[model samples]
Target chain A: MKQKVYLYRAFERFWHWSQALIIFFLALSGFEIHGSFSFLGYQSAVKYHNMAAYALVILIIFAIFWHLATGEWKQYVPTAKNIKAQINYYLLGIFKNAPHPTRKTVLSKLNPLQRLVYLGFKILIIPTMVLSGLLYMFYRYPQNGSIEGLNIESIKTIALFHTAGAFILVAFVIVHLYLITTGTTITSNLKAMVTGYEELEDTTKSQLESKNEVISAEVNNE
Target chain B: MKKIVISLVLIGLIIISIISFVSPKETKQSKLNELKAELSKKTTPSVDHSKFPILQKKIGSPQEVTEACISCHNGRAQEVMQSNHWNWEREEFIKGRGVVYLGKKNAINNFCIGVEGNELSCAKCHIGLGMTSSSTYSYTDSKNIDCLVCHDNTETYAKAPEKGGAPDQTLDFSFIAQHVGKPKRSNCGVCHFLGGGGNNVKHGDLETALFEPSKETDIHMASSGMNLGCTECHKTEKHLISGKMYSLSSMNRNRATCEECHTDNPHSETVLNQHTYKVACQTCHIPVYAKVNATKLDWDWSTAGKLKDGQPYEEDDKDGNHTYLSIKGNFKWGKNLKPDYIWFNGTASHYLLGDKVNDTTKALVINPLNGSYNDRNSKIIPVKIHRAKQPFDPVNRILIQPKLYAEKPGEGALWKDFNWQRASEVGMKEVNLPFSGKVSFIRTEMYWPINHMVSSKEKTVQCNECHSRDNSRLAGLKDFYMPARDFSPVIETAGTGIIFFAFAGVLIHGVIRIISTRKRKMKV
Candidate 1:
């Protein structure tokens, strides 16, 4: 039997969807500003990119506080116990219709591999983009307005880092999109995210049913 | 928890608003106090000239006035005669270029041509009296020196044009002579501000506004802050000014520079101090010039004779800048101009009267600021590049200074008759230079170094101004690589190649994993 359980909270859904929208908008505008086709024009694209970046920062700050208050940060605490199983499940086991090594619950929403990848994205890629973007925005400062002879290595470094981080994020998003489709049904996982409720197999209920039968048989023998 | 987050956000925004609004007002108040303190340090001239008996005498010619002045102040006229202001000559052996004899007298400029036959008009700027075309003036004569041009403190003394450098006849000469004292900013700017015929025409950095300037116009000469006079930086010896014009200077040593007062290591950071080796102080300090008035950017002499029904026509551009004028040819003027950057080692090479130019398609450089990025002594400096299209001899391939000003009409003056050939021949004859009689307008450029109208540190250009990728101000400078602005093709290729290989590896890995998974599933 399958039972529906509440998964993502209301604020969590809001943060996730808003962050996704802002990132998508930022990527579209940023590429346009980088002279890739230029649909919105360069000037308008730059303005939109800056506004989206600020929106993303504000969302990130709010999401951080929410995650801490709800203690949902523990979901991303990665462990190596089910790492091999999860990798095999995706590589070969999933093709043969094997069961998943790690079960989803309210306390443990993300699997080990998902936790590791998301943790890297959160701690490394996102921060790198934010910091490098800031440095690129204010590259000429800290010289006290005497910029004539100042050598600006910081600007070049920031540009390279920001570009590299964007590529990493793009690759992560591609893999994440593919992994989300690996659920029991294509629309099932996406529906769970929208409604904040997921239907998982009642494994504990089945175990208790078998134990109750043994206890009844023992009582008959007595 | 949500309320707490909202409250924190609101508080953070309030703090930002307060800082953005209130801090600037505090800084402005402090700046005002600093300026007031600076002004209190200066003192006006002490020696009153009104009580002197020698100055009270009635004067006939300017020479007589000079004679009476030199009787009391001995050797003063001799000192004035030795200066470049009086002699109009600069002789120095510059490096790379050989011994150069160049000055305003011989240096051919695009504006008004040379001063050979037009001495009566040009001598208005001269420090001597009665310097006409036919006048056999002796440099040794003290009576020929003009004393009132510099020492006048009454502010009423004015020079009459085409009067052999004499003062205006209506001016109270005795009163001006009585009030003679140390030169003010007005006295120095009377000729300099009005150089090349009108206000804000030549030397884009200087203008009449500098007489009672604000801190925004000039940091050093501001009435409130520093209150510096011309002599502060142009420190003179025996009435000979220390600074030389870029069109004439050839000497290689001891020119007035910001490093003389402000040490090379002015910045707090050591890295910034090290930059002084390759960058000039004025480049950052005076980010722009011609802040107070519009300066002449270019003059096209070929369009001088354009007329509407036999009357001289004048036109203005979309920006209200003077684009065409029949009396003074075509002109392009601009205010608050950005300076072109150059590497200069404090020396300039001028195109003397007979010097051959490279080509007519390109501008003949009246004077080029000499330096290279490879030169250790060179520093990046800012300059106002004034472009002009003036007459040059096609046969000789040299610039010809056609006499443009004439006392009367149709006397071989380019302005009067709009005849280039006649004016070129007559002007060349006066200077003893041969002319082939073939005159063609050629583009020419003069580089004027920016050294004034410095804004406060807060008003300077921001960092992205130069480091930007498109339409950057520093795009023309290619000697030194600017990060984020310039890129290496090899490095870019390698970086992109790495990313491509990484993406390919991920695709290959995913394909292999899927192939193995499919085979295992088939066996099961």
Candidate 2:
């Protein structure tokens, strides 16, 4: 038997979709600004990129607060449990229609490999992009009838790091689009994110129900 | 129902971000004023010339004013007499020619030719009185010296053109003599700003707008900042000015430089400081020149005699630049111009009067800056290039100084007779040079160093302006390779080849995996 369970919250779905839209716009406009393409024109691309970047910053701030308040940040923590099994499942077992190594629950949504990749983006790549972009924006400021801000020697390094981060995001998005189709069905993960509900196997459902009942019973006795 | 509220919040955040980006930019005038007050800490003059009793006497001529000035300040005229301002001559030791004499009076330029045949109009800029090409003015005489030209604090005193360096007779001499103080901007700019016959005609850097310039026009000489005067940098000792004109002298001992104040390492960044050794300070600092007025860049004497019904015809271009003039020539003027970049040390090689030049096909370099990229002491500098097609002596292979104007109508001037031979003959006779009598027009080029009208640092050149893919400013300049703009063909091919192989490998591996998975499912 299988049962439907609540997986994603309303704000979680909102933040995820909004952040994805912003990143997509930023990447397209950013590449145009780097002289990769010329569909939007250089000046317009720069303006759009700046606007999307600001919106992304706001979304990130809201998402960070929500994660901390709801204790959902724990889902991104890397663990050794079933790590090798998850890697092997994606590499070879997925093509043979084998079972997944780890099961998803409301409290723990991501597998070990997914946790490590998301954590890398959150801790390293995002910060690098934000820092370099801000440096480029405020490089020159009018002070005392003269421009005297940002005593940096050159903008070459900042440009290089920003470009590298953009390429990494491009690769990550391509792989992510393919992985979302590898659920119970091709549309399973997408439907769960949209409707805040997912179908869980009978064994996994019984295990979660027993864990909740024991915690509630303990709280009642205390 | 909860998703609707989340969507509204996201929309609200985007609206706020856009509003912040489009907010109005505020001007910081008060901050500039505070900075100006802080930088203006120089000491005032100690002596006041208004208390002198000899200046109270009546004066008719400029000599009378000079006599009254030297009555109080003894030996001042002797000091002024030793300066080039009084002699109008400079003697330099050239490599091929020993001890060559060169100065404004001795050199032949493209504009207005030289001071010969029409010295009265030219003497308006001269320091002494009653100077003519024929008459020998006494330089040692104290009465011949004009003190009011440099010491006039009153803006009223001015030397009228064709009056032979004499102040206008209408002004009160006693009041001007009493109000005498240190030279102001207007005093020095009276001649310097109006050189080469009119305002902003000769030098692309110096102009009348520099009288009280804004910070954007000139950071150092801005009225809102340090507010420097002409004498501040071109410091004078014993009445001898320190500045040297590149057209007049190639090298000099008294040349003032920006390193005198800003030092070698002015920028905080080590990379920018390293650039100072290879590039000139003005190359990056003074990005453009001639901001206030359009400067004349080219003149074609071949098109000079265009007439409309026996009257001189004149026409202006779409930009209001004088394109054709019967009195002068066809002129091309440019405003806010980008300078041509070149390598220059502290010296230049000049084509002096009567110097034999070859290569009539290309433009003759009247005076070329002496330096190259391979030289250690040379730095990349910006210069205003002035090109012209002027009359030259083909037989002698020398540039001719044609008398362009006359005080009276019958002086055999080029404008009067429309004859280059008569003007060249008269000019050569007056200057004591051999006349070939055979005249021809040749293309000539001159370089003027751009050092004034410096903008703030942020408005300077960007990297892509010089290091771009096509039509870059540094396109013809070899010796360095620019990244992002140029790539090595060998390295590029190797990198692309590796990427192609990696992509093919991934495609084959994924296809094999899919086929094997389908075959196993079919067997089961």
Chain A TM-scores, candidates in order? 0.86, 0.88
lDDT digits (tens) for residues A1-222 of candidate 1: 787878877767767777777787877776554433446655456555665676677768887878787777867876776799999997667666677888876666788898898899888989998888766655545433455575354345666676667666665665666666667665667888889988887656434565446335534653
DockQ of 1: 0.06
Predicted model with the maximum lDDT = 2
Q: List the residue pairs that clash in candidate 1.
A: none
lDDT score of residue B84 within candidate 2 = 79
- Please compute DockQ, using alpha carbons, for every candidate against the native two-chain complex: 0.06, 0.09
Relative to the true structure, candidate 2 has a C-alpha RMSD (angstroms) of: 10.8
Candidate 1 ranges beyond 4 A from true positions: A1-222, B1-40, B44-46, B134-136, B307-322, B496-524
TM-score of only chain B in every candidate structure: 0.86, 0.86
**Prediction 1 TM-score vs. true:** 0.66
**Cα lDDT of model 1 by residue, B1-524, tens digit:** 55566566556546654554354355445655675575457576676777878777776566667777888889877788777788887777767778866676678777776787888788888887777863355777788888888888888877888876766777777778888877878888999888887777888899988998999999888888787889878888789777767776766664877776665666543334555767788877887899988889899988787677877777987756568877668898889899998888878777888778776666778887788875656788888888898888888888887776788887888767667788889888777788998988889898888888888877765434554567666778877655435655655566456656656755665676577668887888
Local distance difference test scores for all models: 0.74, 0.75
- Model 2: per-residue Cα lDDT at residue B229: 90
lDDT of 2 by residue, B90-189 (tens): 7776556567667766676777767766777788888877776623666677787888888888898888777767667787888898888778889889
